[model samples]
Every structure is written in structure tokens, then in C-alpha cells.
Target: MKHLSGKLFISITAYCAISFSSQELAAQSDVLDINEIGNVDISTLLEDTKTFNTIGMGIALSIAECHGKDICEPTVDEGEIGQLIETLDQRIEGVVSRQQNSEEELTPIITAYVDTKEKYADYLERLSEISKPEPELPQEEFVEEDLFTDEDALTEDEYSAFDDFEEDLEDDEDLDEFEDEYDLE
Candidate 1:
């Protein structure tokens, strides 16, 4: 276990050494040495859009195939870095072109959708404003009270009228029949 850990440590150390020392990575990253940090221009580094991408955060595979504690050297040449940058630039250009093409294709469809929505909104507004007659309230038939209508007045006195009503009741045979049936003598 101890030997394995030591081998792992040595491999990692070698990887770091190669990554920091390689002229290929140095040209792109501007980070030539671990100790000479004061030489790195911070403003320039930040301005370079592709600076940090090439700073060798890649997985360290043992390039030289050293078994244990042997010191390893970087083999990444300038040509390899150039090819890698070219490939990335081509891929980015292709992606940007595809995005622009898709935008052009969709613009007309989006515009048509917006126009249809606006037309529907205008139609809805016109439908809302369409006038209809207000429902006619049932004309409350107000018959005029006849203020000058003639009515017959009693010629006889009030007491005499009551006596006449009682005499008529006694002469009615149906009233007598009803009284007999109800046992009212």
C-alpha cells in the first residue's frame, strides 16, 4: 500500500511538472512556471478569452510510461496545441452557424403566431363592442282611473233598505228549505 501511494504521488508530481513546463501550454496559458507568478500579467490574462481554457486542467495520463519514481518530461509539442486550437475554433464556428440558421428559420413562424394572436384580440374587442337593443321593460299598463264615472244612489233611507232586505229573505223558499234541513225552526 505504501509503495502504491508513493508511485501515485510520483506520477501526479511528474504530470504537474510536465503541464507547468511544456512550451505548448506556456504559449497558450501564459503560466510558464509555478514559482514565477509575479511575471504573469493579470489584466492581459483576463482579456485573453482562451487563456484559462488551455491551462492544462486535463486529466494527467502518464505519457512516458515511467514505472515508479522516474522523473517524466513533457512531450506535448507546439504543433499539437495549434491543431487543438484550430479544431476548437472550427467547432465553435459550426455551432454559431447552426444557431443563426435556426433563428432565421423560426423568425417567420414566430411573427405569424404573434400576428394571428393580435388579429384574434382585435376580433374579440369588436365582438365585445357589437351593440344589441336594451331589453324592452314590460310597459306597466297604467289604466287611468275614471274620475267622472256615474253610479246610482239610494233613493230610500238606510233603515228602510235594511227592512226591505229582511222581507226579501223571508219570501225566499230556498232559505226556508235550508233552515229545515239544518233543523233551525
Candidate 2:
């Protein structure tokens, strides 16, 4: 029984370690590959255009949300944005070059794609501007001033009366008993 339990524990530990290491490796490899741009075919480009259109619509919605509630923060970082644009440009160039080499009469389609991509880039810029956090105004430090000088202070009798009231409140046995009873330490 002890041997079986020991083997089970070791297996579980090894499985958990392997899972965690794989997840870490996946996270580290989450960068976009620009070289893959050259390998994109027309079918893949068409599919990617649909995705780009969806992304554009999402950006429009984000703009609307920003205008409506002023809280639409950007989901993509600047570095990632730059990488995406670079990859997109590379893909378009690759497609155009390949078409030119093949003597394919479908250059218009590639031109249209480039135009659409340019518009998407413009939208991305607008989204970036819209999602930027507003600059905060500098806060002023508060310095309280003495409202009344020594010559304009309260009279000795009035001060004594206030002190007496404070002392009386502090010495109230009922208040102390109530605080202790309520556990109001």
C-alpha cells in the first residue's frame, strides 16, 4: 500500500511539473513571426482579411465605448501594435511580389487589400489615441492657516468652559461601560 501511494504521489508531482513547464514555454513563444508572411497564399490572405475586418469592427466598437464611457483602455501594447503592422506590411509586400512574379492578372485584388490595410492602420492609430489615459492635473498641497491670531483668541473663561466639557465627557462612566459592553475597543 505504501509503495503504491508513493508511486502515485511521484506521478502526480511529475505531471504537474511537466504541465507548468509546457505552459511557461508557450508563454515565452507568444511572439508574432514576420517570416511566415512570405508563405501566406491567396486563400489564407482572404481568410486573414476577414479576421482583419472583424478586428476593425472591434476597434470601432472600442472607439464608441471610449466616447460613451471614457474608459475604453487599449488591449494591445505599442510594441505589439508595431509588430502587427510590420507583419501586415510584409505579408502584403510578399503577396504583391509573388503575384508580380507569377504574372497573375489579379493585381487589383492585392491593391484593394493594401488599401483596406492602410485604412485599418489609420483606425488603429485613432484607437490608440482614443484609448490613451487622460493626463492628470497636478494636485496642490493644502496648508491650513491660523484663522485667528493670539490677540483674537477665545477668552480664558470660555476656554476653561470648553476644557471642562471635554473633561466631563472623558469621565462619563456610562459611556465607558457602554463601550466595554459593546466590545467597541
Candidate 3:
């Protein structure tokens, strides 16, 4: 009787221990982990277009990788910097449109855009210090040929042909037969 009671107690204890550990693990999974949060400070990087694209960012990455620590900014010219920002702005707007304006999706893209803009801005400021005015090359004399002179240029007859072609395209007998594919008003 004493041995049986001891075995029963041990079995109960073991089950309870297993249950507690599993419950603890489940609880931990439900909580947010601080380490997994995106906390990388990108404020120092300029939010410009050049750093936004893969190629431009690749050049920037090479510099960063070569440097042991984070540097303050890039050293690109002011015009180049502005171009970069404009390009980045266009890209961000396009992405936002495609995502249908969802805040969750826009958040990371916006952050990256801003960071690139800031980095390029910094690079522009630095460039102003030792930058020289680029020497202007002699302008080439304009030798113009009219676009209308091109062999593919549409003539009055060609334009009329397009109308005929469009009429032919609209004359699809199959479209009317497939009315069941759509509901009529």
C-alpha cells in the first residue's frame, strides 16, 4: 500500500510539471518579444531616390561595408541629390498606389523613402564644400528631321485605315453570342 501511494504521487507530480511547462511556453508565445522589433535608427541616412533603388543602394552599401562604423552622410552633388529624392518620391507614390493605401504596408516603405531622402540631402550638403562647376561642352548644331518624315508616320490614308481596323475589331460576332458571360441591365 505504501509503495502504491508513492508511485501515484510521483505520477501526479510529473503530469503537473509537464502541464505547467507547456502552459508557460504557450503564454510566452502570446507575448511580444522586444528583440524582434524593428528599432534600427535610420534617421542619419538621407531619404533620397539614389539610395532607394537596388543599384544606387548597392554603391552606398559598398561604402558602408568598407567603413568600420556608420558615417554621417554621402558626398554626391546637389543636382544629383535632388534627382535622387524626386526618383524616390515617384517610387514611393507608385508603391502606395499599388498597395491601395494600407497603412500597414505603407509604413515600412515610407520609412525607407524618408531615410533615403535624408541621406541624399546630407550628401548634397557635403558636396557643396569642394564641388566645382562642371565645364560646359560646346553645344552640337541642331540637325533636325521632322517626325512626320519617318516612314512609319501615319498619312491621311493610314489614319482612315485605323478607323477601318477599329471597326473590324468592334465587329466581333462572338461577343454578342457570349452575353451569358455578363448580365445585361
Best by lDDT: 2
TM-score of each: 0.23, 0.45, 0.32
Clashes of 3: 14
Candidate 3 per-residue C-alpha lDDT over 1-185 given as tens digits, one digit per residue, 9 for 90 to 100: 99668645644553454345335433432331223112222231222222243333432432333233333232233565576567556555655554573433455656676676677666455454442545566555344466356687888998999999888777765566566567541
Local distance difference test values of all predictions, in order: 0.44, 0.57, 0.48
* Rank ordering of all candidates by TM-score, starting from the highest: 2, 3, 1
Model 3 TM-score is 0.32
For model 2, how big is the CA root-mean-square deviation?
A: 14.8
Model 1 segments more than 4 A misplaced: 1-56, 59-72, 104-185
lDDT, model 2: 0.57
| Number of the candidate with higher TM-score, 2 or 3 | 2
Cα distance off (Å), candidate 3, residue 150? 43
For candidate 3, the per-residue lDDT at 28 reads 38
The Cα RMSD in angstroms, rounded to one decimal, for candidate 1 relative to the true structure is 35.4
Cα-lDDT of candidate 3: 0.48
